[model samples]
Target chain A: MRNIRIAVSYDGTTYHGFQTQPIGNTVQDVLEHAIRMLTGEQTSVTASGRTDAGVHARRQVINFETSSPIPVNRWALALNSWLPGDIVVLQADEVAPSFHASYNARRKTYRYGIDTSKFGDVFERNYRLHYPMPLRLQEMKAALAHVVGKHDFTSFASRRSTKTSHVRTILDARMEESEGKLDIFLTGDGFLYNMVRIIVGTLFWVGEGKLSADDFKRILEARNRTAAGPTAVAHGLMLWDVEYDD
Target chain B: MRNIRIAVSYDGTTYHGFQTQPIGNTVQDVLEHAIRMLTGEQTSVTASGRTDAGVHARRQVINFETSSPIPVNRWALALNSWLPGDIVVLQADEVAPSFHASYNARRKTYRYGIDTSKFGDVFERNYRLHYPMPLRLQEMKAALAHVVGKHDFTSFASRRSTKTSHVRTILDARMEESEGKLDIFLTGDGFLYNMVRIIVGTLFWVGEGKLSADDFKRILEARNRTAAGPTAVAHGLMLWDVEYDD
Candidate 1:
């Protein structure tokens, strides 16, 4: 058996999520279906993590074992012919037999986009969160600065998480603004369910003057999900990148 | 009755086109329906021009006569509440009684986007044309430069056009490239049916070295539709702006 790793990008507007489910079509379902048609093997593909419905991905990593004789580099070209326009295989490579896409991931980066323009752009309605109200940019930046470093992120995680430990090490957190749009970037070793979306939601409150930067820190220390703001919509979030040890 | 002029923008992926058709829903149909719901008037709207199916608009000028007493500035917000998210009224104003959207227009601008990346972007699939091949940028620019000034555009127009004269003045034509993507901008006093798309199609031939710059100029002088290249797809084109004499 050979372990094959692939990077993909998708416009998740029509998909249920990244994982295979019994009820609805998903990114994994389409990928595996394409693989089955190309290789004639019933194989399972593992991804770094799952993204929610309407969420997008710039680069998502996946790994699968195959016994086919096709060259590794040709897999992307072959699979893309069977895949739809909304999902594309960016690159494919042969890795060690023991490589695991999920467990071997070292760090992941996510980006959230918010458009504050009056009457949001028509072409970007599916890709950005439209928040027309004025925002306190400096306050939002100050609040995000406190999000870096190691912490128990229970307050930012969704209640659906069943993990025993909510502890995760955040490597970096920052925001960039241009032309009435704000992009928040977060890099971390691991993330819980809905962690990024909840963090962005709480920052919206800080930007709206309902909570101060110090209050944000206190909420993180509280370690209660109710202490955070509402979860932001999923369409604005994108899986930016994934890293692994070489 | 007062003449209300509105500038609107639409994604155009879901609608049939800008003009109302007998079989399918269109941007004009939606706007007229929204007007009926808001003001109880079955009003007719006139646009600067008709866009083909799947063509987008960044700023389309439209005018309608309304007997309802809604203020001019509030029309955007009121109409937006009744319209879908894909279409938005950017601004509204009270214009002169004799001002017409189609007849009084002075100039119009359009933009076409092409992606030459190895693998096209998923998020921009609906907005740009994906042509994964090397292009001769200098040749395409030279070919486009000859398109400026008044000329008989019979070769670039579609066979369906019934106009008596095919003469039009192209004010400016240029292109800009960034990160494997090219944006072509064209401004003119007017365009015939499918004129801009046919021009882009001919330029594509020049980019691929199938035709030379001087050959493109000769095709324009031929004044025969069979001498020109194919008509490009409509989804990559956008109505950028419309200007009228103040």
Candidate 2:
């Protein structure tokens, strides 16, 4: 059997999330079913990470083993034909047998989009967070600088996470605004559950003048979830890119 | 009664179209309802144009008359608070008593988005047209030249149109491709019914090698509905902007 790596993209609005659940539809369930129909092999596929419902992914990595004789490029077309319109396999290729989708990931980048206009956009409701108030960009930028390096991000992690390590390395964090839209981009070695959302919410507080930059720093040192702001909505977050090293 | 002009935006996925329809919800119905809720006034609103079902608008011009003493900026906030999340009043101001949303327009711009990747985007399913094959940009550009002049666009209009004059002047027509996405932008004095969609369809056919640039020009001269390509899906089109001369 050959191990195949597939790069996928999905609009997660219709999905329960990236991982399969017993109650609702998932990106994984539909993808696995499509693979089964194409190759007639009941193979379990693993992704680089799990995204919550209403979140989107531009380039999500997944890997599975199959014995089918189909060419690598055909995997994308074959699987996509059976999959629904909301999920699609962007590219597929053969990989080393030792490669693992989850274990081999080097870094992940996520983008949180906010529409700061007084009025929201009708078409982008599913993809962006609408915040009517004018955000203080300079204050938000100062607060972001405090979270750019490695730290124990317990303040930003969700309480439901089972991971023992609360520390992670944050490579970069920045905010960009254009045409009345504000986007916060974060790149890290790995993220804890709801880490991105919580960080965004905390930054929003800074933008709103409710929390100062020093307060953000204090929250980081607290190492407690209660110190951070509320988790932002799921729809505003997107897994923009996942990096893997050879 | 004071004449009020408002800039509106709507996600057209759930509505039958922009105009009021007996069959399904519309942008007008929602906007009128929101206005009635805000001022307790029976108001009649007129739009610059009636957009078809599943077609979005970024800045649609609308007008109404009311005696309410509310401030201009408050109109947006009040109407938005009562309107559904899919529709929003971006701005509101008092216009001259004789100002008409439909008759006083100087120009309008429409944008059509196409995702040409082999895999479709699930998140943009309601906002873009997904074509799996690679498109020829040069051919599409060549065809666009034929559409950038004054002409009777009966060939590009639907037979169901009620407008008496099919002649319209196209100021600009261009195609842009970025990040595997293709966008067609058209600016004109006005458009015939389904004119923009049919033009896009014909350009798509030209890009796909099914038609030539000369063929597109021939169709424009035919002045018959059968000469043009099929009307592209409404979901892929957006009323991007409307311009008025003071």
Candidate 3:
């Protein structure tokens, strides 16, 4: 058996999520079915992480063991031909059997895009959040500073989570604003369910002057989901990139 | 009766174009129906020009005569509630009673967007053309010079046009390129059907070294539709804006 790794990008507006479900309209379901048809093997594919419904991904890594005779480099083109237009395998490679898409040591970067352009950009209507309200960039930055570091992220986690521990390390966090568009980028060792969206929602509150930077720190220390703002819209969030040791 | 002018924008990928048809799916058909539903009166809506199927518009001028008691300022908000998300009315104003959407226009600006970004952009999937070939920018600029002044543009027109005269003035023509993207902006007194798209297609051939600058000049003077390159795809073309001498 050979372990094959593939990098994929997808527009997730019409998809249920990255994980397989009973409904079978998710990105994972579509990709697995295409792989099954092409390689004639019914196998489970593991992803770097799962994204919610309506979320996008610029590059999501996945791995699976297959016994097919096809060359690893040609798997991308072959599978893309069978997959839908929204999901595309950007590249494929043969990796060591020890490499796991989810458990391997690495960091991930996510971005939440907000369209401040008045009347909004029509081309990005499905991929971004149209926020017409005024935002204080400086305040948002201050709030972001309090989020960088290793800490218990229970305040940023989803209420439905059943994790054994909520501790995680936030490597970097910053906001990029230009041309009436704001993009919040966060790099971390890992994220809890809905953590990035909840962080962005809290930053928006800071920009609106409703939540101060000092208050954000207190909320983080509280280690409770109810202590933070609402989770940002799912469509605004994107799994931008994943990094692994060479 | 009062003449109300509206500036509208739309993602026209799914519509049958800007003009009303017996098919009842055109932009005009949808707009007129929404007006009737909001103002309780059936009215004929006039547009500055017609757009082909799958073409978009950032700003299209439209006017209509109505007897409703609603103020013009409120029409945009009221009509937006009734229209689909793809179409939006940007602004509304009262024009002179003699004003016409199709006849009383001054100048119009159209743009053709090319996704020089390899593999195209996910968000702009429906708004741009994916042209991955290398382009000679200097040669394209030189070719655009031959198409700048007043000329009989019969070579760039489509066969479905009913206008008697093919003579038109090209007020301005230029190409804007940035960050693996190219945009061709053309401002003209008026245009024949499919004029901008054909001109773009012809310029692309010049960039590819298939046609020289001098050959483009002769094509312009030939006064024949077969003298030029094929019409570019409708998805890349957009009616950017319209200016009127008020």
Q: Pick the candidate with the highest DockQ.
A: 1
Q: Stretches of candidate 2 above 4 Å error?
A: none
lDDT of 3 by residue, B1-246 (tens): 999999999899999998877776999988998999998999989999989899999999999999888987798889888888788888899999999987888999999999886455666667888787899888899889888889999999998778899999999999999986899999999999999999999988898999988888899999898889989999999999999989
Give lDDT tens digits, candidate 2, residues A124-207.
777899997877899899999898888999999999989999999999999998986889999999999999999999999999
Candidate 1 structure quality by residue, lDDT tens digits, A1-246:
989999999999999999988876999999999999999999899999999999999999999999999998799989999999999999999999889989999999999999888888887888889999998889999999888999999999999999999999999999999996889999999999999999999999999999999999999999999999999999999999999996
- Tens-digit lDDT string for candidate 1 (B126-193): 87899989989999999999989999999999999999999999999999999868899999999999
lDDT: worst 10-residue window of model 3 chain A: A117-126
In candidate 2 chain B, where is summed lDDT lowest over 10 consecutive residues?
Answer: B116-125
Question: What's the lDDT of the predicted structure labeled candidate 2?
Answer: 0.90
Clashing pairs in 2: A11-B123
Write out fnat for all predictions, comma-separated.
Answer: 0.80, 1.00, 0.17
TM-score of chain B of 1: 0.99
Every model's TM-score: 0.98, 0.94, 0.94
> Which portions of model 3 miss their true places by more than 4 Å?
A69-73
Ranking of candidates on lDDT, top first = 1, 2, 3
